[model samples]
Target: MVRKYSKNDEGVSAVIGVILMVAITVILAAVIAAFVFSMSNGVSKPYTVGITIKKTTSGAVSIVNSGGPDVGQLEHVYVTYQPVNGAAINAYNGEVPADGPDTDTLFDYIEKFDALKTVGGSFTIPAEGVGSPNKVPPTTPTHVIVTGYFKDGKQQVIGEADV
Candidate 1:
């Protein structure tokens, strides 16, 4: 025998079911997003530190330094490689003769330390260990310090470079 259905319960259960389904979907999406973000960072950042000696006949790769009064603007560009233990804030790792804390200091440090050598975004090995006068191979360096003033985001390096 069929039982009598209540009018009040008819729409309420349907709405509750729909709401529960939406909530579950949102929670799962959030959890998935968090996991993916965490994993992506590991893929991007290096686990250790090592200099990438790129074999380029055009004196390796360097940035075009200039000025634009703000970040994201391509201002002064130059070549940077390696780091000094007790080097000054504006000091160059033997890359440039006249070393001083300039606006491009952070970029210099970031480019040098960043293991993600995609296109023109990493340190270069000049003819010699010293980043000056333009040297060549045999004198090419393998290690780099890559020191920055503050954490900023340097902790990203989770590994070292094979080169």
Candidate 2:
């Protein structure tokens, strides 16, 4: 009498199914981890500060801080005057003169704002000596940029305008 052996493939199929499930779970976890890490990098919100740019009757440009919740955290401020046909002048840390030819009292104004961090902090770029040696000219539009530096080592452009 010849006896035929029955094939026992049930155990092999169960093992393969378990391996497949584990592989899928690992792949899903990796995808979710990557997404979470990528999103976490941009979790910090930018500070909000109100800034206003106004044109004066004397052909000057004024940049003012209108106050905000984050104003108290502001450590320093920088002002840049870029004329249409002249080199850019940067005012920061009392570098610009209070009153002199080819310069304005921007540094003094900014210094006060940095110290006080109050609303209505303003600086003016004059157009009186336009085309002479002044950085801002009335006839030609000038671009003004105001940057605020925070105590947390964050820097942002608080205001910008062409006047």
Candidate 3:
């Protein structure tokens, strides 16, 4: 006696189930990867800076980076002078030298004046620029405001001193 076999489709559901599971797993993995990368590559926060100011008899002002963030992390240093009895003005606004703060001694704040490049580094305020010596003369009580700028254009008032 010969036996005849009947065709059946019972395995179709198993194959489709496997495909669906694989697709779901792939999608989940992609989403997780996106979240991980975004968290790891987020923008950096701004840094804090510490500075010291000194005024000379000749009407020259000097500054030193006392503490806070490293010099290489800064993009520029901004200085503003506001006389007690006079209008406020900008003393200096210049980019930090790409080479870093000059190590040579600062004879006067204006001598080899470099924007504060390094911590414990110093620079002179010249008689030039807007709100500078020409406008804010020495011997007058003034408020000096120093700011540190980041490469991203964010800035923070790092130091303030009355001279």
Q: What TM-score fits each model?
A: 0.26, 0.62, 0.49
In model 3, which range of ten residues has the least summed lDDT?
105-114
Which of 1 and 2 is the better model by TM-score? Answer: 2
lDDT of each: 0.39, 0.67, 0.63
Error of 2 at 66 (Å): 1.2
Question: Scored by Cα lDDT, where does model 2 land?
Answer: 0.67
Error of 2 at 22 (Å): 8.3
* Error in Å for residue 137 of model 2: 2.5
Query: Which 10-residue window in model 2 sums to the lowest lDDT?
Result: 94-103
Q: Could you give candidate 1's per-residue lDDT for residues 1-163 as a string of tens digits?
A: 9999766746568789999999999999999999988886655433322223334554333222121222222222223333323332221355332453354544655444332332234444444344345432222333222332223333332222222
Candidate 1 has what TM-score? 0.26
Worst 10 residues of 1 by lDDT: 64-73
Q: Kindly provide the TM-score of model 2 when superposed on the true structure, using C-alpha atoms.
A: 0.62
| Cα lDDT, model 3, residue 118 | 72
Q: Pick the candidate with the highest TM-score.
A: 2
- Residue 116 in model 3: shift from native, Å? 0.7
Please give the ranking of all candidate structures by TM-score, highest first, separated by commas: 2, 3, 1
Per-residue lDDT for 4-66 in model 3, tens only?
999896866888999999999999999999998889765666577778898776767778887
